[model samples]
Target: MSGRKLRQLKEAMATILDDLNRGDLFSIVVFSEKVEVWDPALGEAEMQDNLGRLRDWTESTTDAERSGTPAPSVITAITLENTNKAKRFVQNLTTYSATNIHGALMKALQILEVGRSASPEQTNHAEERPEPMIIFLTDGQANVGVSDTFRIVSSVTAANAGNSSIFSLALGNGADFPFLKKLSLRNSGFARKIYEASDTALQLTDFYRQVASPLLANVTFRYQPDQVEPQSVTRLAFRRFFSGSELVVAGRLHGNNVTGEVQAHSSSGSARYPFDPVILPTTPTANTMERLWAYLTIQQLLEDDDASTSPGKQRALELALTYSFVTPLTSLVVVRPDNETRPVEPEEASFAAADRSRAPSHVSPVSLSSFPVQGAAKTSHNAYSRILPGGYQDMRPISSSGAYYADLILPAYPVSTSASLDDILWLSPNDTTVSLPTGVNGTSEVLNLATADETNAAYAACVTPGGQPGHCRHLKYCVLLTFLNNQTEFLPFFCRIDSFVGVCCQDDS
Candidate 1:
């Protein structure tokens, strides 16, 4: 977090205080290596002693670290004086240490007076407590106590007595947007990224305004069990529905229509609304609709993923830690609940991989499928990944023969994906082999063991950094290129040719 952003944040906090009324109760908890819960109602000595006890009960620490302990959760009501005091505390705040996200959140939940438990369990009559929500803001990665991202989320979720909505603000660039988003989503809330600009403070207060007014709580969307696939329904149970926001429901019906209902609790009393036989126009093909659902499902897994978008990227790896959830980065290893192995298997140092033959019946196993766990954070940015057709051809000349170029034959390929072949220009004969992969990147595999398996291969257009778009083709297939010998018989005859990609760039007639 930069100094300028810090000042902006303080300003935003003051603005939030100004907006609060007596009906709202709040607490201020800051975390570095330790947590400090500022309760204006309590004296400094009393606050320190109370915090010391809370620390001793939760973690293992020494007397020296006791001073860093935060005071216990106080039932402090919002008031002009208290808000002013809190503003002073925020303005005077200037300290630095490791980021203990887990501890900070735990303290916040404690202040909300939510039921605390060591492990997650069923909560009955959860509506009895006051409507609780936390507007959490943080920058930087977790480095201190319980730095594990998933564990931090899971633990806080387990301890949530009132099931509070946690709207997280990921301020500044490189603020681990994925982590904050996940944390918010799991708690029936959402996350927003705050750009570090002149109006950053405004961004903070504006987001606060969105979740500030609650219209409904414990909202549930229901559909006839027989009408829709139960597994296909996404986000049926939401924590709360604010006045300005609308609920989104998406699912496939068994027939043309399905009956559904919305059940929730409002200020007056319990509320229920019926939505029977909802019919939607289907002018598109079944395939297109299927793709729509598939894309929607995919959006959840690879949410807000931009690391692999650049054409310069050569490879990407998603490792699992704590639990296998739909997230971007992981630091620790955990038991993988599911295994995603590619259908193609390696045998005798060679394997038959899918090629440009048919539309993908299913997504590639290499792609990350999101499996949300209870209390896991929501992810942003769906990752856009395309299958690379195996690897570049080893198109090197063994001998030189005068072969003339003729008409081109674009091989049998799968879908065009982002574009179609147009303005196909023959590659320059002077264009010699450079490095491996040939064009930018999608995967980092080599075709050393297998021939360009046409029957089962994934094909797509690959462009170089120089804006030269072309396809990988065999040298023997690329007109008659004279090699040292019958080099066409060996692997050195393959090269990514210019223009149309696939079996041949220009047919050697």
Candidate 2:
């Protein structure tokens, strides 16, 4: 972390300590290559006293670090007292060698479990269970012990044992968004990304406040048959729900049914909050609810696919293609006119006449036509654009050749006028590659691009400073390309397509 980021984290931690209620139980676990828990054996009263001491210590250390002194080791622990220990721990945290995410998470889980078992009296009371949860924060990929994402997630899940929820905060652009998101989703919590900025402290505080307010826990949504029975129902269970958040569930009707009853099951499982379902008049309007349901279902299936189930993977692909989503199983193929090729001028084509001196001798030029072509299929962009409000008409128009162009919007930088098609690549769910179309044409013969790994390797070799692969490992499937007026001016730039409903943007270089 940068000095600015460290300061922001300290500020956020102070705010969190201030916001905590007196009866609330909390713990802090910090890890680099090893884990450290501050005040591990301190009781409630002793912990509070330790917190005061920690506050003074942290202030002194902060002053030293700000004066150009090297940062000290991490200080972390858990507590139930209203003390500044958590704040001081955050302030004293320093960037270390490798990120031991698995160790940190495992240690947290152990603490929660120990707390639960050690206090059976408190565990018996629903309100006194302490709402065991792990708020995991990380800024980089796991490079220490048990670095494999799936293994780490599985270990966390097993450690949770359905008693605790894991709320993950991915700090900065380097954090693995997908890994954190999936981890939280599977464990009955949610993941959020915290971008590095001046207001990062404020963002962290707000997120803490939101997660701190849990209106309901272990919630389940069920549909009861009143007039008719539905053909199927999607799984509707969440580990925790915030005070102001909304929960939506969607399903299909078996017949021409109009009325049904939906019930919500919460902590008091027997008590059901029932409501008469309302069916809005179906017109030519976009089916936002249905699409949302599909997206959620696909997300669940993808998470389940981590278990190596082939059926779940197949179902996710089916939904993605049905909705025109670019998933691991499908690629977005852009078709343009085959006659749009530019001719090489005789003078410009001559090796001697060309500006060879400006080009690197060690690097070889790659042609867009080098990619293979596949067949074309007709599809709409509605599935991809439904996340945005308004309606289908608000979407950008499809080109006459049936090509869909999505504008890449970035808040920090100006949008590119045109992006090289060579820059467009497909990223699979597992961060593996399926295929990348080098270029596309309106003709029946579509370009069949190289596999994701091959394309990434080639692109990495040419773009990376060290000519090493995996340098662009963070590159996702969602790519924003520059829109050029003439296709012949550069290689065809394709949009980063995904199985989910969201906009794509350029990678943070």
Provide C-alpha RMSD values for all models, in order: 19.8, 17.7
Clashes in candidate 2: how many? Answer: 16
Structural RMSD, model 1: 19.8
Best candidate, TM-score: 2
Deviating ranges (above 4 Å) for candidate 1: 42-73, 114-129, 277-281, 284-292, 301-509
Q: Ten residues in a row with the worst lDDT in model 2?
A: 369-378
In order of appearance, the predictions have TM-scores of 0.51, 0.56
Where does model 2 exceed 4 Å of error?
40-81, 117-129, 225-232, 255-270, 284-286, 307-309, 326-388, 391-509
Q: How accurate is candidate 2 locally (lDDT)?
A: 0.46
Estimate, for each residue in 1-509, the C-alpha lDDT of model 1 and write its tens digit: 54888888888889898887545667677777776566576554554455312233123455455324344334345566667666776776664546778877877776666223311221222333346778888878888778788788778778775777888887776567778877877776777667665446655765676567777888897777976767665557767876434443445555654666789998668999765532335544223233324434444444423345632121112211111212233121222225421122223210112111111212221111121211222111113211222211211222222111112222322222222111112222343321122111111112222224423232323222122343444432333222212211112223322222233222212
